[model samples]
Structures are given as C-alpha cells and as structure tokens.
Target: MQVFKEKTLLKAAVKAAKSNAKIIGLVPTMGALHQGHLSLVKQALQECDQVIISIFVNPTQFDNPADLEKYPRTLEEDIRLLKQADPELWIFTPTAKELYGENISAEQFNFDGLEQVMEGKHRNGHFDGVGTIVKRLFEVITPHKAFFGEKDFQQLQIVRKLIDKTGLPVEIVGCPILREENGLARSSRNERLNTFEREEASFIYKTLLKVNELFGTKSAEYIQNWVEGQFKNHQVLKLEYFEIANTQTLEKINRKRKGNTYRAFIAAYVGEVRLIDNIALNNEE
Candidate 1:
C-alpha cells in the first residue's frame, strides 16, 4: 500500500486513479485498526476498484484533550493489517497539520437537532469536531463512495445528514457492526481493557440485549431503570446514558411501542476508557 502523508500527493494519487476510470472507495479512520475497521476496509475492497483508507487521529473530534492524547496509535501494526487485507489499497495517513494547516481556528456548522443529544450532550463539541474533520476528508478524497461502521450509529446518521445537506457527491455506506465471539462490539478502545476489564466490558453488549428483550413487553421507563441498575451494580462501569430513541431522529422515547423501529444506545466508562454501543429494535413479530 502506498502511504501518503501529504494532502497534495494523496490528491494527486486519487486524481491519477480517477483519470484511469477507476471507481474509488474511501474508508476514513483514526489509527489502531481493529476487526471492526478491517470489516470496513474489506467492504470497501468488495465494492470499489480502488480503496483509499485515511488514518489520521483527528484531534478536533475529541472534547477532552486528555482523551485525544490517550487515544491509541498503533500505526505500524495498522498498516501491516491493511497491507495484508489489500496490498494495492492506498492509505492516506496524514498529520493534523497536514489536514487542518497551522491556523487551528474553530469553524462552525449547524447539525440541526442531531448534535444536541447522546454523545453531543456528554462530550461537548464532539460531533462538531467530527463533522468538521469528516467534511474536510470528504472534500479531500472526493471518492465515489465512503464506508462507515454502524457501531457509531449516531455519527453515521449525522454523516449521512451532512452529505445530504452539503450535497456531497459520495454514497455514504453504513456497514453492520462486527462483534467478538462474546458479542462485545470490536473497537479500538478494546485494546485499553485489561483481561478482567475485557470480561466486564462484555456487559455493555449484554445490557443492550436486556433492553432489547424488555422493549415490547415492558415500558421504556422499566427498561431504562433496569439497564441503569445493572451498570450501578457492576461498580466498575460508570454509566453515561442509556437511551431508547427513534433510530432516525434520535429523540428519546418515554412511552413504549411508539413505532416499528427503535434503537437502544449506551455510553459507559470502564475505568477512564469510554465505550458506546447500540442495538436496533425491530418489532416486526
């Protein structure tokens, strides 16, 4: 894989590929490639003639400076995995300075109602940073299609909205969340967990399953209380939020069975590491 750290060279490479009439697929990621990330890369390779994976730990997206500093960066191993996946795929791993330049000024973009709840409420300006950097990457790569994991279901929704609102000419594809044998969603942060913590971390997925079970028979209030109680009982995990909301709008649901579709999303802290996961409740039975 050709690794380009500069935007100019990466753009040139993409332009060259386009000139050859090759269909381009972009998989944007922060370094520390996990099975989840590789799933995205594999999907991109399946769909397009050329797959471009951009790995820049976007500093703008982090609400906490410490979180950004602590975020994993296993670049050597990440590239090794990418090379094994597809040796021909171009990997654009740029620095913050390369992508954002030296100014570092805060620019504003309105996300309508999408940015005010869940992750947005917990981590201030998190999605704005996400939107900003993603917009920049979308502009730079200009690929025919872009792939994102549904693990970050809200972020995927915001990205799709951003493309529609901005009229970006790239198809935003949301791939299914890849999980471990134990059902815990694979994430870069999973590397931070110790053996015991990893065992406890599986509770996040289990809690979601509990909520899913309670969806039709019980009220949202009951499900919410039960999920929250489990986190409290765990002691090791600090619950951030446990919500059942309209999957598309993300508006919190108070009553039960309002619609055919609902999403259960949770964000909790296992030690200093924050993890988020969601499950779609399709009441079709």
Candidate 2:
C-alpha cells in the first residue's frame, strides 16, 4: 500500500491515477482501522479502480478537549490493519498543520437544520468540523465517489447536505451499519470500552430493536417514555435522548405522516463511554 503524509505527493499520485482514466473512490477516516472501516475500503475497492483513505483525528469536531485527546491514534497498528485488507491501498495521513494550517479550527456552515439535532445538540460545532475537513478532502482528492457508514447517520445526512450545498462533483455512497455479534454498533470508540462496558453496551442496540418493534403499535410518545424507563432502570447505561423523527428533515414528529418515513434514534452514556444507535421503523426509501 502506498501511504502519503504530504498532500503534494498524494496529489501527484492521484493525478497520475486519474491520467490513466481510473475511477477514484475516497474513504475518509480518523485512523484506528476497524472491521467496519475496512468494509468501507473493501466496498470502494469493488467499485473504483483506486481508493484513498484519509486518516486524521480532527480537533474542532470535539467540543470536549479531553475527548479529542483520548481519541485513538494507533497509526502503526492502523497501517498494519490496512495492509491486511489491501496492500495496494492509498492512505493519506496528514497533520493538522499540513491539512489545514497552523491555526486549525472548524468553519461555520448551515446544513439546513440537518446539523441542529441529535449529535449537533450534544456536540457543538461537530458538523462544521466535519464539513471543514470533508470539504478539504473532497477538494484535495476530487474522487468520483465517497463512501460513508450509516453508524453516524446524522453525520451521513449532514454530509449529503454538504455536497448538495457546495455542488461538489462527487457521489456520497451510504453503506449499511455494521454491528458486533452482541448487537453493539461497530465504532472506533469501541476500543476504549471495557469488557463489561461492551457487554452492557449491547443493551443499547437491543433497546433500539425493541423500539423498532414497538413503533406504529405503540404511540411515539409511549415509545419515548418506554425507552426512557428502560435506560432509567439500567444499572450501567444512561439514556441521553430518544426520538422518533421524520427521516427526511430530521424534525421531531409526534405522529408519523402517511407516505413519510421515520426512524428510532437513541444516544446514551455507558459510564464515560457514550454510544449512539438507530433503527428503521419501517421499510427504507
């Protein structure tokens, strides 16, 4: 696999690949390669002639400085894992100064209220941080297609809005959410979770499944109260928020309208390690 820590060398390589009429696929990440991340790379490999993986832990995205500090940065191990996946992969491991500048910060962008809910409310400037890096990556790589996992459903949606707003000539491909055998959503943060915490975390997904089953038959308000009570009684997990909302605009809806789609979203704190999960209440559009 060819890895580029400098954008100049990376651009020359990408330009060379482009000259050959190769279709480029981009998978942006923040190091810490997991099975779920490999799945994105694998999908890109299947569809495009070449794939680029960007690994940089963005600071502006983190409202809490401690969270950013605690974020994983196992570059050597990450490279090892990616080598196992594909020895021919292209990885862009840029420094904040190299990618942004000495003064690194997230820009302000309105994602048409897509950033005003869920993760946005909990983590301020998160989407703007996302947009800042994503815009830079899209500009730098200029790939034909970009891949993202649905685990960060809100982030995925905001990214869609971002591309639409910026009119960037790239396709945003949303991949299915990967989960553990115990039903916990696969996450980079999963590495920090303790054994007991990981087991307890399964309840988060089980509760989301239960919420999916309870939808329609149970009123939205009733389901909301039920989730609140479920986490309230739990020994380890604490419910941050649960909402059944319209899938389109992400606005909280009391009643599901006919011909409209909805999903059940849950965010909870498992001690210090926070987890978020969502499930489709009905067939997807």
Candidate 3:
C-alpha cells in the first residue's frame, strides 16, 4: 500500500484516480485501529474502486487534555492490519503540521441543535474540531464517497449535516457498529479498561437495548429514568447523559408521541474510559 504524508502528494494521487474515472472511497480515522474501523474499510472496498484511509489523531476533538494524552496511538500495528486487509488501499498518514500548518484558529462552522447536547455538552468544542478536520479532509481527498461507522452515531449525524449544508459532493456512508461478542461497542477506549471494567462496560449496550424494548409503551421521561437507574446500579459506570431524541434533528423529547421516531443515546465513563452508544426506536421498519 502507498503511504503519503504530505497533502500535495495525497491530492495528486487522488487526482490520478479521478483521471482514470475511478470512484474514490475515504475512511477517516484517528488511528488506534480496531475491528470497527476495519469494517468501514471493508465496506469501502466493496463499493468504490479505490479506498483511502487517513490516519491522523486529531487534537482538536478532545476536550480534556489528559484524555488526549491517554488516547491510544498504535500506528505500526494499525498499518500492518490495513496491509493485511488489502495491499492496494492507499494509506494517508499525515502529521498535524502537514494538515493544519500554523493556523490554529477555532472552526467557524457550527452545527445547530445536533452539537448542543450529549457528547457535545460534555466534551465542549469536540464536534467543532471534528467538523473542521473532516471539512479539511473532504477538500484534500475530494472522494466520491466517505465511510463512517455508526458506532459514532451522533458524529455520523453531524457529518451528514455537514455534507448537506456545505453541498459537498461526496456521499457520507454510515456503516453499522461492530460489537464484541458481549455486545459492548468496539472502541479504541476499550483498550484502557481493566478486566472487570471491560465486563461492566457491556451493560451500556444492554441498557440501550432495554430502552429500545420499552419505547412504545413507556414515556420518554420514564425510559430515561429507567436507563439512569441501570447505570446507577452498575458501580463502575458514571452516567454522563441518557437521552431519547429525534433521530434527525437530535432534539430531546420529553414524551413519546405518534409518528415521531427517536433514538436512545447514552454517554458514560466506565472506569476512566468514556463510551457512547445508541439505538433507534419506533421507526417504520
């Protein structure tokens, strides 16, 4: 696989792919590769002629300095896994200087309602950093399609809005969340958990499933309380927020109403590691 560290070289490579009338696919990641990330790469390979996976641990996305410092960086292992996935996939591993240079100004673009709650509220300016870097990558690659995992369901929603509002030509493809056999969502943060904490973390997905099961009969208020109770009972978990909101706008709903589909989303600290997951409720399907 070809690896380019400079933006100019990467752009040139993408241009050549476009010249040959090849469809381009992009999987933007913050390194520390996992099964979930590889799942996106696999899906990209199926739908596009060439897949480009960009590995840069974005600094702007972290609200806590310590969390940023603790974040995993397993580049050599990540590259080996990608090479195993496909020898032909282009791997763009750029330094922060290569992408951002000297300009460290705050991002100007803002997501309306989507950014105001859950992960956004707890991790201030997190999605702004996400939007800033994603916008930059979309410009550099200009791929026909970009792949993102549903494990980051809220981020996926914000990215979709980013494409819609900016009129970026690339389609934002949301791939399914790949989970462990225990049902815990796969995450780089999962590495930080000790053995007992890892076992406790699976309850987050179980709670989400319980909320989904209670959707139609229970009011949003009751469901929210029940989910909170589950987290409280789990000694190792610290609840950030448990919400039921409109899947499209992400506006929190207080009551269950007819014709409105909602998503049960939660973010919590399991030991020192933060994890987020969601399940869709009351869809026509």
Model 3: pairs clashing at backbone N, Cα or C within 3 Å: none
lDDT of 2 by residue, 38-127 (tens): 999999999999999999998878999999999999999999988888898899999999988887988899999989999899888899
Count the clashes in each prediction: 0, 1, 0
What's the distance in Å from true for residue 249, model 1? Answer: 0.6
- Over the stretch 9-71, how does candidate 3's per-residue lDDT look in tens digits? 999989999999999999999999999999999999999999999999899988888988998
Put down candidate 1 lDDT per residue, 98-134, tens digits, no spaces. 8888965445767778889999999888888888888
Count clashing residue pairs in model 3: 0
Q: Candidate 2 local accuracy as lDDT?
A: 0.89
Once superposed on the true structure, which residue ranges of model 2 sit more than 4 Å away at CA?
283-285
Q: RMSD of candidate 2 to the true fold?
A: 1.4
On the 0 to 100 scale, the lDDT of residue 159 in model 1 is 94
lDDT rank order: 2, 3, 1
Cα displacement (angstroms), candidate 3, residue 219, comes to: 0.8
The better-scoring model by lDDT among 1 and 2 is 2
Error of 1 at 174 (Å): 0.5
Model 3: lDDT equals 0.89
